[model samples]
Target: MKATDRTPADLLRSALSEDPARPLVTFYDDETGERVELSVATFANWVAKTANLLQGEMSAEPGERVALLLPAHWQTAVWLLACSSVGVVADVGGDPAAADHVVAGPGRFEDGLACSGERIALSLAPLGRRFPTPPAGYADYAVEVPSQGDRFAPYAPVDPEECALIVAGAAYTGAEVVEQARADAPGLDLTGPGSRILSALPYDTWDGLAAGLYAPLAAGGSVVLCRNAGLLDDDALARRIESERVTATAR
Candidate 1:
């Protein structure tokens, strides 16, 4: 039998061990004309720090729910993995009042307040920089994440069969997500370190999460994530594909 990848973090370990310097996630904002690329080790560092922030700064515990209020950007992906690392269930667009925390982008900062709990805001700026001025009622992820330790050892090992992702109508365990992504990769022609998938899919849905987030990580491939891709012209898209060495696109 083929070895089963147990959890979302398991893929990160393989990617990090295989090629720490390889590009793991490349993010683009067509509307803002912003681009950011992160290698495996760099991405892992961000994950570690964010994981620590979730467990330490936010006081998030295993089995707690966190509503994800961001877009399909790279930072959002980091949060998904961070929650998984700490065994926090990531609720994408789920009810906020029912959650222990809410992570929102600037666009929805006010809307996010409707949910009563710890609020973390992302300026969503290039390089995940801090807001020049912090939001009054929210913790600035950019500022706090950097202060966290680079190395992260989860308080305890996460159970693979536990709920990890919550979406519109369904919830998936960490093992289910990993297994499905591993199964879906070959159909997408993604298999190994050389794969580079440029996905324009919005992350609010399970399909988008699979194509743009989990699949690449599972296959040891990289993702070129695009938000506001509809605004980009054909020439812009072509250039992105070429410059980023994108081997596939979920157009």
Candidate 2:
């Protein structure tokens, strides 16, 4: 971690400054045979827009909780960093009723209605296409976020000691989360920058978060995130590992 890095947002900014052209996240949906790669700049742009949407449109204040009912897709990774940038506590798989806001994918639209606050839905489609018909009482994230400012400046500064994420009923402050990511990186065999780690783990636990997103970012590496990887035949999986140049895996 850089000397100036105290939060995950700082890590992202550092990554962007260091290598904007390098692939930051490579996403694959083996179930759909879809693949998308986002460079550091591109991913950061998405994060900025999403952060703007959360802060301005959703009226999410610093320290507020946002329930994330999504999978381990690239967009989910964007939302995680977006929440961090704006100081909103990202609660993964958290109860909708308890959140100040909710971001849900198509599969969790009905459940997201439990959030009395602002609710947003993602189509999770290829190229982030909007839903055929928008869900009732929910703002379409794909539609709304695009119009949000490409650059974001948080209205309030994020406190590293403040709670930034909640996973599996355990809360982790911003600093602690960064610390955990750095600690996990070596054990996960993340060999510093440029290490391409492929992860098939779901984003519902600290271990999964460390492998699929945080550790790679903290280690100045990148991740190949695969969804429904179990569906891939052994031959196909082997080909993917070889083609993607996977150095390690967290499955």
Candidate 3:
């Protein structure tokens, strides 16, 4: 489908309505060694709620940038989808300084462009605790906005030509590569609802975001996102492929 045809929110809405009970996310946490499953309905609601929070609580307007310095997790997925649903530009990158508003993990990096002045600090891990109070003009995430239920109306219409995600790298070089890569991606045999994709790439990369997430989701297939590519030997990967009946994979 063309980018201009429909927004990300449209795709999400369709997914939720078509199969509300279907598993939208299967997260494997290495820390606790646990697997958590989230259904389409639940994920959609979380996205809506997060979007509503961004709008009502944070006073974020459509098209404004929200920087996410998070790893691959359910929360990250919800944040990305929520930004898309509300027409807010989501900048997914390693450097939080590039974004006007920053959401970051605690104790990572405090002094930066984003942290300099009146910036917002949003904590995702602790969930309810607030800490590391901004020096002066800054505001805490929870204090600034009131918590509300996860309920949001769909966006009317959004222009897809506008930038949705921005990755960090040398501008000219990466932009050309990204254009070429996006063109090359569709040519792959990425069809089949039962097909499974195994991706070792990070979520921030174009290939990771497109093929690992968007492509499979668009094609009605499943994806397995691996945290450490180095740890997965050929034998292990092959075993997973066989066990899961994975039909396709991205090296």
Candidate 4:
């Protein structure tokens, strides 16, 4: 992380400034044989559009809670940074009824309806395809997010000391999250620049979050996130590690 980096958004910005074309997130769904690669600039653009949608359309105020009922996909990573960019607290697997806004995957669509606040739903399909029938009382994220502005600027500066993430019932401020991610990098074997760590951990806990997303960013590296990794045979996994140039593994 740079000296000026405090919030997770800052880490993203630093990455973008350093190398816009460098791959930041490479996601693989072993069950579906789907693979996607997103560069730093591409990911930041998604975050910007999502942030705009949250701040302008949802009217998410600083410190407001956004329940994220998603998994360890690339879109989930986008929403995490988007929440940070807009200064809202991202509550992973949080109580929907208590949130000011909700973003849920297809499987959790019914559960997210408990939130009275604005709700968004992701199909989580390959290539971010929209659902054939939109879920009732929820904005389709693939439909709405595309129309949002490409640039995002928060109305107020995000306080690094303010709570930014709630995972597994523990709240962490933006600064603390960054510090913890930085600390996790070495142990996860992400000490060198351009380190490519492949992770199959879910995003419900800090360890999963660190290994899959934050630690790679903090270490100026990229990640190969695998979902449904158990479905891949040993030979296929070995080929993937070699093809993806993976330097570390986090399970």
lDDT leader: 4
lDDT by residue for model 1 over 1-251, one digit each (tens)?
12566888878877787789989899989888888889999989999999999999888988999999888999999999999889999999877778889999977887778768789999998767889887778989887888899988888889999999998769999999999888998877787778999999988898899889899898889899999999988998899899888898896
lDDT by residue for model 3 over 53-137, one digit each (tens)?
7766666666667777666655677777777777667777645554556665445336424543225555543343465664344
Better candidate number, 3 or 4, judged by lDDT: 4
Question: Residue 96 deviation, candidate 1, in Å?
Answer: 0.9
Clashes of 3: 0
Clashes of each: 0, 0, 0, 0
Whole-model Cα lDDT of every candidate shown, in order: 0.88, 0.93, 0.59, 0.95
Residue 61 of model 3: what lDDT? 66
- Could you estimate the TM-score for every candidate? 0.95, 0.98, 0.73, 0.99
Task: Tell me the alpha-carbon RMSD of every candidate.
Answer: 1.6, 0.8, 5.0, 0.7
For candidate 3, the TM-score is: 0.73
- In lDDT terms, how accurate is model 2? 0.93
- What are the runs in model 4 whose C-alpha is more than 4 Å off? none
RMSD of candidate 3 to true structure, Å:
5.0
Candidate 3: C-alpha lDDT: 0.59
- The list of candidate 1 runs beyond 4 A from truth reads 1-4
- Of 1 and 4, the candidate ahead on lDDT is 4
Question: Residue 233's C-alpha lDDT in candidate 1?
Answer: 85
